[model samples]
Each structure stands twice: as C-alpha cells, then as structure tokens.
Target: MMKKKLWSLGIFIILLSIIVYWFYFSKPTSFPTNEQLVAEMNRVFPEATASIIQDTIPIDERHVLAPFISKGDDYGLSYWVWKNHKWKVASIDTKGKPMLWKLNKSDPSSFYFVWNIDPKDQISSIHFYLIRDRGYQITRGIQHYNPKVQMGKRVSLQEKSYGLMQLSGTWVTFMNAYNKVESAKQYPERNMFFGWIPYDQKDMGIFPENSVNGASYSNGEIGLEYLMIVDKGQIEIPR
Candidate 1:
C-alpha cells in the first residue's frame, strides 16, 4: 500500500510539472512579421495582400489587432491571440471600422451612445466636413489626411459599458472634415456633435434646427441593431 501511494503521488507531480513547463517555460514561436501576417490573413481572404489603415496594433504580448485591405480595397479586422502554445486567429470582423475604437464612454449622464447602426455601412469610414455648432452655426472645412500627421478629435456619449452591445452602438454626430477651432485643440462646441444636453432638459429645444443634436437613443436591447457592444477591457471586447 505504501509503495502504491508513493507511485500515485509521483505521477501527479509529473503531470503538474508538465503543465507548469508548458504554460511558462515553453514559449510559442515569435510573433508574426508584416509579411507573415499578410500571408496568414490570406487564408480567409483569397485576395488579401496588405493591411488597410496601418500595420497590426498590439494589445499585449498575447493578443494583436490586425486590419487588412483586400486587393480589391475591401477592408476587414482580424484578431489574433496566442493560444494553445501557438498563434491562432481567434476571430475576424470583416466589416469593422475604427469608429468603435474612437468611441468614448467617460460620462454616461452627459453622453449616451446610440444603439443604432447601419449594418451595410459597417466598414465605412467617418469623415467630418460639416461643423454644426451649438448656436446653429455651420462651417465646412477641407480635411487633408496626411497619414503621417495624426490630427482630429473624437467624442462619444456613454460611460464605458463593459457589455458587447456597444460595438454596434454609434452616437450620432455631424460628419465634418475639420474642426473650426483647431487652434484651441479642444473638441468643437457641444453643437459639433449630437449628444445629450447633459442638463436642463428643457433647453434641448432651444437649439436651432440646423445644429446637430445628441443623446443616446435606444428602444431597449431588443432589435437587430443592438447585437454587439464594446468591452472596456484591453484585447477583450465583449460581444
């Protein structure tokens, strides 16, 4: 009986050691390079060649966000993760745009994200050309995207909700090319985007018809539009 007990303990120790080694001591292969990544992406998209906007955005040592544009110019987002001791393509958002990444959820009461999205326009890019100020002022500016220079501001209406439903949630804002007060380096007046007035509900009506209005709009979570939301966690967007 004593010998048998010792043998059983030895087997258990061996299994535990293997697990520890596999998880920590044994690392997976190196991260894929741009060329290797493009090849990997070709598996799903036959005509895939290069990334869409930029190269892969690293979330951490184990996770990466890759956006690709097909030879035909169609765009897509692919999420890769290190799993089972190998790099695996966990999932892909074929029609995802970077708008969701720009969405802000800092203040829920003052801002609410609209749960309505035009699925047909999923991969569409946002261009703000018309600035609708709170005073019903409107201005159009020519925005030149130099690719090298990062400029512009993004606003959102929501407290960073952890649920995945926010992925499809899009707060309505005027699509403008450039902000009028670029010198100030602040977001255009409250009228530039449509979000809730934050306070004095009755004042919402005082705004002119030409200005953009904002506030979160939803008929509860029961509809085709409220399918996926954004997660606040890094490399972990709940859907």
Candidate 2:
C-alpha cells in the first residue's frame, strides 16, 4: 500500500513539473504593449518622428509586421521580432510598392502573395498577371515592347472600400503584377508592374500600369501597402 501511494505521488510530481515549466520557462517571459510597439518603430527609423505605426499585424507572440508612413510622405513595411526581452526590427524593405511576395526556401514550387490594393470607385475585381516576358527588349538597348503576362484569375471585391485576397498555392511563381478593373479586361488606366516596369509607351499597352508601380510614378501615385511573411502560412487581413 505504501509503494502504491509513492508511485501516485511520483506521477503527480512529474505532471506538476511539466505544468510549471511550460507556464514559466517555455512560455514567453513577457509581451509588448501597444505603446511599446510604437516606440520600437521609432527606434528602427531615425527619421520616423511623425511616422506612426498603423495596421500592425502580429504574426506570433514574438514577431510582428507593420506599415509606417513618414512625415515626408514615404511609406514601407517593417518586420519586427521580439528578442533579448525586447522587440527588434528584423529588416525593413524600402520598396514603395505595397505588394509583398514571399518565396518558400524549402519548396521552390510553393509561395504566398499578398496585396493591400486601393481601388477607386466602381472597382469590382483585381487581377494577378504572371510575368514571363518583359515589356521591352534589351538586346541592343531600352526599347518599348508589349508585355505578355501569363493568365491569372481575378478576385472580386466591393467598392467604396478596399479589397483583400490572401491565398496559398503552388501556382503563379516568380514576377507578377496586379490591377483593378470594373469588369473583365477593363480599367486599363493604371497597373502595377513591380517586377520592374519597362520604360515605354505612356497609357499605351501596360504603360501607366507598369509606370504606376515599378520606379515610374512617384510615391504620390501609390495608394496601398503590402506585407510579407516567411515560415508563417496564413494570416487575417483587416478591412
């Protein structure tokens, strides 16, 4: 009978040890507050005095993503990771485009794409075009040529607000572009060719669209922001 009681006590002690370890050492020591996040952004950017942290997404208890618009009208995405008992900026991409594409290291065939597009009034759908051909030829020098974008499906959305589409797939790898349309093949006024907009025809072919994203139009022409994640599979998009 004494041996039986001792065995029960041993099991209880082991379970208690696991529970205590998980609650204390295994779990996070602490978490950051909203105000602390804002301060961390400031610490990342020296000239971010007027830049406020907006639309922050926490990927995990130790990682987060955010967008910062500077006082001079500059904007980009900032990724932060909690380390050494504080949140630290992992890396910052200064690309003006609000589109982010993440490539999977282990599996080359799988990847994730995200877009925070600003659709004008009457916009109903957004199209993702896979880029396999350049808009211009570069054998001799820079020349204006038509862009042959691979066929990509369109995602529908309502207007008077923005649209968001987040999906994971093994298709549409490499360079891509997106545009807002009222209907099929409509709204040719502007397109974003982020892979690299070729110098060519304005408002002709994929001009304004190409120019709209890649280094063509100034930051004034941009309306949306994009966030990217690696190792993170899925996330909720805010409206």
Candidate 3:
C-alpha cells in the first residue's frame, strides 16, 4: 500500500508540471514575422490574395492586429491570437471596415475599434458613437423610462489610414454600470451599439467609396462586431 501511494503522488506531480508548462511557458515569446503572417492570411483566406503586409500592431503579448493590402487593391484586416502554442488567425475582413474587438469580454477597457480604410475613400476623419435608444416600458404595474444615452469620439485619419481607438473612459464607465443593472440582462436588445460616420476634409459626411460593398470572411474565433454607419441626421446636434 505504501509503494502504491508513493507512485500515485509521483504521477500527480508530473501531471501538474506538464499543465503549468503548457499553459504558461509553451506559447512562443516572439510575435510572428511578416512573412509568417502573410502565409497564414493566405492559408486562411485565399480569396484575399494578400500581397503586402502593411503593419503588425500588438494589442497585448498574445494578441496582434495586422493590416494588409490584397493583390486586387483591397484594404484588409486580420486578427492574430497566440493559442495552443501557435499563432492563429482569429478573424479576417476583406473590406477592412471599422470593427469592435472585445479582447476581454467582461472588461470594458479591453474593447477597441480597429480599422484600415482605403485612402481612395477620402475619409479625413471618423466619428464613433456609443448609443442606447430611450425606452418606455410597463412591468408589473411599474412605469419605467430609460433615457437615451449617446457618447461620441472622433479620430483623424490624416496621420494614418489604419489604426485603433480604445473605448474612452466615459464610455467604459457607462458600460460597466449598465452591465450591473438587472434590466440590462432582461432586455439585451436595448443595449448600446457601436456606430460610426466618416467625414471628408470638407467636414461633410459621405459614404465610403470602397468598403461599403465587398466580400468578407471570418472564422469566428473572436467576435468582431460590425459597426453601423450613422447618418448625420440620426445624431443629436448641439444647439
């Protein structure tokens, strides 16, 4: 009996050691090279026909965002995540329109909006919004009214065509508070949406010339939420 107990203890120690190594030390310490990224993009999305890798932006130690240009002159975006000891493409978009990527779903601060808009569109800047429409409901003879909430952030595209914008502190605070409310859980449809409006140098809103119509693909490893395009009339203008 003593001998059997000693053998079991030894096996348990070995298994724990393997688990530790696999979870913490097994992943590659370095980011994938541009060549490796291009190959992976081609392998996952042959339709992209990716020809040039524009840049690799590291979101964290294990997550990366790469913007690329295809042979057909399409601006595209690909998200890479280090998983199972190898770099994997989490998602890809041929149009490279603005998308909300939640790196850590439970934490609002980890959310980011990333895009690679085509220069031909003449987009000088972008206005991003976090909005929740007002609501009125009667539940159990109680009158409930939810006020419309709207928040906006503008980013210039003059400096660079491809970039990322993290959720503002105000937006994060609102989201954190909303998530705690019981009503939010009950009415998921009433939750806020991420939207955007592109403006030209003349400060006029215009539909993007290229990205509006295109074919896109995703493997669904990561949830890349599409941002709705908002018309100027839809937003509240300050008096």
Candidate 4:
C-alpha cells in the first residue's frame, strides 16, 4: 500500500511539471526592437517620406494597456494575439487610435519605437501592429483601418470639447488651413497628416463649417462644399 501511494504521487508531479513547461517555458517572444521596426517600415514603404513621428511613437506600454475592469480581471479588449520568434504580443485597434499593446502583469518591459508613416490621398488602407512577450510566450497582431474620401454636407462649426494642448499651437496651424478652405469655394487643396494627437481631442479632429447665413454643415456633406487640411504630422487623426 505504501509503495502504491508513492507511485501515484510521483506520476502527479510529472504531469504537473509537463503542464507548467508547456504553458510557461515553451513559448516564443515576438516583440520588435526600434531598429527592427524602422527597417521593416523602410522595407515595406520606401517611396513616401518615413520620418519617425516622435510624438506619436508608442514606445511605452503603460498607456497602451487598458486600466483594470475590476480587481480580479486583468485582460482588456484584446483583438490580435499571436506568438513568434520567441516573443509574445497582443494588440487592439479602436479604428483611428493607436494599436494598444498588452503587457505582463508581473514584469513590465520598456519599449522604444519609431514611426515611419506617410500621409497621402491615394492610401486606401492603414495598419498598426503591436507585440509583446512574457511567461516564455510570444504573441503579435495587426489592426488595419481604411480611409475613404467621400462627399458630405457642409455644416456650421460648433463648439466641442478640445484638449488644452490642442489650443497650444498644435492645432492652431491647422486652423489657418481651415480658414483658407472656408473662404474659398473650391475644394481644400491640402490634406492633413498625422499619427497621434492629444488624447483629449483625438476623437474630435473633424472640421465644422458655418455659412454666412447661420446654416451649418459638416465637411464632405452634400450641401457642404469644403475640404479640410490637417497641418500636424505627429498627431493621429480621425476620419
């Protein structure tokens, strides 16, 4: 009886060890280095100007991860999940916003990244990818958002929420371009390009128009004949 009990305990320990190794030890890491990312961008898109938009560069994972939904749950709204090259990554894209990364709860890693995106009217698609690795597991994912230019009715400019930083000259430059479009009957010649904006005003980046007769219309509307030119490059914009 004693021998049988010892044998049973030994088998249980072996099974537990196997489970631990499979879940934690045998995994890949998919995180990309700053250099690797830059090289990838250059390889993929060599034609357009690919400067590192320092402000929009998501190098840290702090703001990328969502805050706790409660005490027990840790995972946020994750969209892409994968493992590659010994790295683990998880990402979520809310359309216009940056692709958020998921970090480890126990050990937080510092990430250094560079942005090499160009703004163009011909672009039909935009994609952002995030990667992370922990617990000997690697994961990665990409989120793609398409930008389509269409006509809409012009409307009056209405007062909406704006970030204090947006008032500090970042968006001021674009205001001039907006005036130029508003004054002219022709379509706005210049288009705005950027990767990130002040988190506060990131959602309300669209241009509003008000006619001389007190009627208002949003840009691209049928009744409205106007165009918006974003002047900032580092700020990400909503379509």
Candidate 5:
C-alpha cells in the first residue's frame, strides 16, 4: 500500500510540473524589441523587406499588431501572437488596408479593425459597417424573410494615420444573437460582413487612388477578414 501511494504521488508531481511550465514558464516574459520585430519579419517573409518598424500596438497581453513601412514604400501590417513558447508572426499583409482581426473567433467583442493608411491619401474620416443582406426563402411550405442589417460607426482619421477600433457593444450583441440562429449556419453566404468607406472633409467617399490599389502577400495563419471598400450608393441615406 505504501509503494502504491508513492507511485501515485510521483505521477501527481509530474503532472503538476507540466501544468506549471505550460502556464507560466513556457511563455516569453516580455515582447520582442522593434529591431527584433523587423528582423523577424524579414526572416519569415523575405519579400516583405520591412524597412522601418512603425508601431507596436498591443491587442492584449498575448497578441500584437505592428505596422511597418517596406523598402518599396508600402505601408504594411503584421500580426504577432505568443504561441508555443515564442512570439510568432501569425499573419502579414504588405498593403496596409483596414482589416478586421478576430482575436477570438467565437467572441465578437474581441474583434478589432486595424489600419495604417498612408497620410498622403488625405483620409479625413472613415465609416465602418457591419452589413447583412436581406433574404427570402421558402422550405417545406414555410416562408421566411430576413431584413437587412446595416450598422455603422464613423471614426475621425484627421488626427492620426494609423489606429485600431473595437466592435461596438451594439455590434457585438447583434452578432452574438445572429450567430446562434439556424439560418446563420444554413446560409453562411448571407452572414454579416465588415466594410468601410473613407471620406474627405467634404463627406464624399475618397477614390482609392492610393489606399486600395496594391499587391499584397499573406501567409493566412490568422483570421484577417477583408474590409470591403463601400460605395455611397450601397448605404442607406437618412430622410
């Protein structure tokens, strides 16, 4: 009986040690420096040829969004995540168009839109939207209609050229409820999408002379949802 007790204690100690290492010791204590980040970018993606490390914006303790300027004068974005005991480049985009990063795919509150637009574009403001198209369907003698959803939040970009925006509470709540419905699973094509429109001081949508025209590279390791450039006619006008 004493021998069996000792064996059990030994197994318990081994399990405890593993848990401790995974929770605390396995992760890096600090984030990588800007120089190190630049090197890592070039190392992982040689085509990126990142010239300057612009900013390191922390999404949470474990995730970071770093925007950089490439040798080709392209404003770019890279996503970092501390996983498997090291900071890894989760995704990289050579063109810095506004993108939705879903930190937790299951949680809408954790979703954020990040961008590093070139200052020369003169983007005075941006309108971000969460849109779902109206739908009609008939199945087994049942008729169903889904109304259009078009929620928007506008942000002033006159102060800065690069930034991040979290999903509003209304957006989060609506997405959560929408995700639970059967239609969301059945007709995934009708699901909501994120989009944006940049406007000048005159409130007219800026033609994508520089912002949207670019060739980009991505490894597709993370969920970086595309933000469609919305047209004025696509949005509803208030009476």
Candidate 6:
C-alpha cells in the first residue's frame, strides 16, 4: 500500500510540474497599450496621429509573441507590440486602394510601397510620406504600372500580342500592347499564354463561355484583342 501511494504521488508531482512550467513559460505574454503604440508612432512622426482596434483576424494566431493591441476608432491608426519591440503602424490602406508596404529588419523603419490598384481606376500610381525611425522624411518613391484592360476589338493571324498576365486568384489583369487575338485556324494550336503575375494560380487560362479557353476580339480600328482569363471552379470578371 505504501508503494502504491508513492507511485501515485510521483505521477501527481510530474503533472504539477508540467502545469507550473506551462503557466510560467509556455503561456503567451501581454501586448502593449494603445497609448504606447501611438507614442511610438509619434516618436517617429510627430505629425502622425493614431487609433487602435482589435485585429479582425486575431493577428495573435499568426505571431507567437504579439504585442498588446490598441483599438481606437476615433483616429485612423492602430498599434501593437510583440517580441519586446514596439512599432507605430501595423498596416494601413488609403481610400479604397491598398498600399503595398512591409517592414523588414534591414529597412526596419524604411517602408517600401506598391500600389494595390484596380484596373478600372484611372489613377495608376500611389504617393505617401514615410518618416524613418531616425527622423529622416521621404516621400513615396515608387511608380506602379496599371493593370492592362481589354485591347481593341479586332484580331489578326500574324499578330504576336497575346495580352497581359492575369493575377491568379485575383480579379487583377495585365494587358500587353503587342498581344492580339488569334484564331485556332491560323495556328491550329489553341493554348493560352501565361505571364508572370504575383500569386500565379495554376488553373488560369482563356475561357470560351463554358470552358476556360483563350479568346480574341476583332474591332475595326483597334485590331485584334488577345485575352487570357483564369477559371477554376468559377469565372471571374476583372474589377
């Protein structure tokens, strides 16, 4: 009976140790306050204001060491802390367009911008002001090319122009000036040309009503218009 009790005690002690270790070391830490986040941003850019809000997607799930989150609806900014380090801007989007930017260690405070654009919008570029951690200020210095729209309405056999590569899984398209539509009879080969686009989807191609097939349009003055459409389970129209 004494041996049995000793064995049970040993098991209990091991379980307790595990529990204690989990509570002391394995549990996640707390995040910084919203005010602190704003203060950090202000330290970099005095003219900047901050607002805080909860991450809609629970950013903590992605980061094991996420800082405290500041949710402010009054201002258009949010703040957070993680890994004992603090940053002012976690993410930002202007108007309807998304600003392509990210922070890396080498360019910690330096942000690179890409314009997340829609082909329908006429504005082809983005502009912003960035303030480095060292108080050096510079304007957004990138020019993003607009996605290609449908070329003219006509197509010819000798034309080499196909069209811009469409971004996979997205409604964004890249139109090329040289590409024009070609009929299956001219080449007797029907294959859609794929161009380089970020996040290229494997199932992208030309569509002809029910099937994803390369297509062309022939307008009188515009000549041949070559187009490639991506189709998987469903068809999508570029926005």
For this target, which candidate reaches the highest lDDT against the unseen true structure? 3
lDDT of 2 by residue, 1-239 (tens): 99999999999999998877765456444556556755765665554442555566654565455655445544445555555444566654332333433333233232233322222222344444333333565556766565554434455544312222333242333322222231245434233232321111121112222112322112222222333211111212234
Worst 10 contiguous positions by lDDT, candidate 4:
210-219
Candidate 5: tens digits of C-alpha lDDT, residues 67-141: 888898777888998776778888877777799998888898999999888777778888999999788889898
Candidate ranking under lDDT, highest first, comes to: 3, 5, 2, 1, 6, 4
What's model 3's overall lDDT? 0.86
lDDT of all the models against the reference? 0.38, 0.41, 0.86, 0.27, 0.84, 0.28
User: Can you write out model 4's per-residue Cα lDDT over 1-239, one digit (the tens) per residue?
Assistant: 99999999999999998877766555434345544433433343332122321222222322222111111211111111222222222321111122212223212121111111111112222222111111122236554332332211111212311000111232334434444654584654333322322111233433221101121111121111111232334223456
Query: Could you say which candidate leads in TM-score?
Result: 3
Off by over 4 Å in 6: 1-28, 51-57, 61-81, 84-239
Name the candidate, 3 or 5, with the larger TM-score value. Answer: 3
Off by over 4 Å in 5: 1-16, 23-28, 139-141, 183-189, 213-220
Which 10-residue window in model 1 sums to the lowest lDDT?
160-169
Candidate 5, residue 176: lDDT: 83
Models 1 onward score TM values of 0.37, 0.41, 0.90, 0.26, 0.87, 0.24
lDDT of 6 by residue, 118-217 (tens): 2222222221221111122233965433222222111121221111111222211221111233232455222323211112123222222211121111
Off by over 4 Å in 1: 4-8, 20-29, 44-53, 99-239
Candidate 5: lDDT of 44? Answer: 82
How does residue 62 of candidate 3 score in lDDT? Answer: 80
Task: Tell me model 1's lDDT, rounded to 2 decimals.
Answer: 0.38
lDDT of 4 at 148: 31
Query: Candidate 5 has what TM-score?
Result: 0.87
Give every collision pair in model 5: none
